[model samples]
Target: MTEEIIIAGFGGQGVLSMGKILAYSGVMQNKEVSWMPSYGPEMRGGTANVTVILSDERISSPILNSFDTAIILNQQSLDKFEKAVKPGGLLIYDPNGITKLPSRKDINIYSIAAADEAGKLGLSKIFNMIVLGGFLKLKPLVQPEFIHKGLEKSLPARHHKLIPDNEKAIEIGKGLIQAVQVLN
Candidate 1:
């Protein structure tokens, strides 16, 4: 199986980190994986994105013009990558700061209130984890054990104390994701 995913958001929103963790999870599962991230020099508030590929066979390249899934965290990203999802693919977004919703009829669309939920949970740093959870709900590509290990591997040892909170955030995200639109 090959899954090509694009995650886009502001730099400080953990967009690249989420992709990294997912790539690590794929590695732990013995799948061939590639992760490529892009961002502007502004860093914090500037747009950031990552492209990740997981497959059972060798990957040809990291560059991609389309994706199987697009996880968008802001309105800008939604506007940018909404049409980039392959037909019949998945488009998941957090509706925060989004003035317009997706309008594609060919792809499946879902929404996750990760930012708001993270605020309510008092663990705002794990916002991306919540988003990751929502993605896992739609696509169970990686095993849970590997995900746990991914967290351990991607996160620093000093901040490992928050793994449980991140895990909880993921659970919250899974429960919060709602289907906005699904192709028949």
Candidate 2:
């Protein structure tokens, strides 16, 4: 199966890092993976986006013309990518940062207050991990164990102490998103 996911947000929101984590997890799960990030003129404070591809077989192209899923961390990102997601695709957004959403009926949208949850959890800087959690729960591209293991390897050795917190964030994100699904 081939799954293309786009993670977009303002600069310094850890969009690229989120893509890296997904790519690394795909590797751990024995899947083909590629992550391509674009900064363009938005590196300062503008928009940043990363496309992450995961497949069961060899990947021909890393670039995606259309994405099957998108995680938007800000309203600008939501506006930029809301129209680009493939039909029947999934779009996960941080409702705390993105106040509006496109009126698309073809795509499924999952809104989570990631930044606010991160702030409440005292891990505001690791909001990307929270988003990753939502992605993992919504998309079965890779297993949760693989993601946890990837997180262990993604961070530097000196930062081993942060792994537990990151793992906690992932679990919290998954739980919150899962609850939303259950409620629906």
Per-model root-mean-square deviation over C-alphas: 1.9, 2.8
Return model 2's CA RMSD, one decimal: 2.8
Q: What is the lDDT of residue 95 in candidate 2?
A: 76
Residue pairs whose backbone atoms clash in candidate 2 = none
lDDT of 2 by residue, 52-99 (tens): 999988888778778899888888887888888999888888877555
* TM-scores for the candidates: 0.95, 0.91
lDDT of 1 by residue, 70-139 (tens): 9999888999999999999999999999988899998999999999988987889889999999999889
Estimate the lDDT of model 1. Answer: 0.91
Q: At residue 14, give the lDDT of candidate 2.
A: 92
Whole-model alpha-carbon lDDT for candidate 2: 0.82
Worst 10 contiguous positions by lDDT, candidate 2 = 175-184
What clash count does candidate 1 reach?
Answer: 0
